[model samples]
Target: MLDYALLAALAAVLRTGSFDRAAQQLHVTPSAVSQRVKLLEERLGTVLVVRGQPCTATPAGLRLCQHVEQVSLLESELRDSLPALAPAAAPATLRIAVNADSLATWFVGAMAAAPGCLFDLVIDDQDHSAEWLRKGEVLAAVTASAAPVGGCSSHALGSLRYIATASPDYLRRHFPGGVTAQALAAAPCLTFNRKDRLQANWLQAVLGTVPSPPTHWMPSTHAFVDAALAGLGWGMNPEHLVAGHLRAGRLVELMPGRPFDVPLHWQQSRIASATLAALTRAVLQAGRAALRPAAAA
Candidate 1:
């Protein structure tokens, strides 16, 4: 039989990132939390958490955490249907992976639409977000993958449009000749991170070849627009973010009339649960409303 109390202790430590914080949440002594975690680890015969300044879960630990969360959500649903079974429990948290661009633009509206639940957001590139679901780390993800991850349902969320944006001054300085592949090679561009392929994808779409451009790694989605406006570097800015600036001539496209659109999808576990269903509904509604239709984009 599983000792849910010990499992709860483990989940609490992983979520709160420390025994003391877990103790506070569970209203138990810190030592009691530690003991429970240790007992659970011994029972499982594997190290679950990597203890550090802020604790992190191992792969096995992450799967367990996901299980705990799913069970909690299921129990919450049960209580909702059977009032007599209801007990006072903290609002269940839904851990999901979403791209930073979506979060800055439209994901929050979906989050707000889903009530009675807390959120633990894992920000990653849309192309890679579905990996979280595959790894059993997240209950749902907003991803660029059209194919569903194993045991997950996939829904189309339309396309997020991106424009290769630069300040007029930067464009004048870097692309005086034109947006040729050779010129693009010498120009400095903003990159979200190593995983970011928006700039490269845009380059390929326009130039038909990827060039080794000098890059400025700016991870924040908003910062990408800010850097483009400040003449720091050109980047593939989300069209929604820089549309006003585009109209005002503060930011200009590397090539006018050519925009890149990434198709996005929502993927979630196939497990039968009302919370997941509610979240999926909100996500589809918000995403469809915010993103451009792929054909139109």
Candidate 2:
């Protein structure tokens, strides 16, 4: 009973997060897309979208959009197999959400392997990137959470090891032996932007008190690593990213024997698109090669 054209338009609007971008992609005026959505909502007797600066789908809208995306993907697969039925162009854009750290490290290789697909990368913390998937902002995500978002599937990528690290000069100038509760309170620490509290959390776990180190806010993951290497302050760095620096003697691991492990997951929508499926498999394969094994039971 639903109009396929209107459903496709709705899916486009939800995917792009704005009327203007969806219209541009669809090669129609923004007004025309808006009219189509309005008509569709009227026919369905539901408020399907929350119109704002960055648009969001209502719960009903999300369900409908998911259905539409699945159908679209299925159709694309069928068309791909039947050359006579194939569309002129394959869907070129794939929207994905990834944490800043993963994006800085192993994710680039997976992306490089995806030669023909255009990517829209949404960067957020691993802990929260799945929310973008739930809202239909992205079709897939690299997240810390194991729980899959609704209508999505998840795979355990592997553990991302974090080492408590600082520059040799910082260690010499501050907590010379090793970091302790009292020493950490007085030291300067580097943080990856405002939302990063891993350093503080580690302090709390070890000492039962949060460190009140004078903080330097370096937002970029790469920059945060660089700042730590430059002896800005003590912080947790992803082991892989800091491996070279540690070997080169540019940085030193503060706690050589103990390391924190953060598990990573790859979450993707349940849509049956061959391209998405292939991409997911490739990422998982790459992750298994790159990451540490699961902790023993």
The local distance difference test score of model 2 is 0.82
**Clashing residue pairs, backbone N/CA/C < 3 A, model 2:** none
TM-score for every candidate vs. truth? Answer: 0.97, 0.78
The segments of candidate 2 whose C-alpha lies over 4 angstroms from its true place after superposition are 7-24, 29-31, 37-70, 86-92, 114-116, 134-137, 147-152, 176-178, 193-197, 204-209
lDDT of each: 0.91, 0.82
Strongest candidate by TM-score: 1
Q: Report the poorest 10 consecutive residues by lDDT, candidate 2.
A: 86-95
Q: Write the per-residue lDDT of candidate 2 for residues 184-243, one digit (tens) a residue.
A: 888888888776767876776667888588988877888888888788888888888898
Q: Taking the tens digit of each residue's C-alpha lDDT, what string does model 1 give over 1-297? A: 578898899899999999899999999999999999888889889999899979989888888888898888888888888989857468788999999999999999999998988899999999899888899889999999989999998998999998899999999999989888888999999999999999999888888889989999999999899999999999998888999999999999889999999999999999898888999999999999999875643
- C-alpha lDDT of candidate 1 relative to the true structure: 0.91
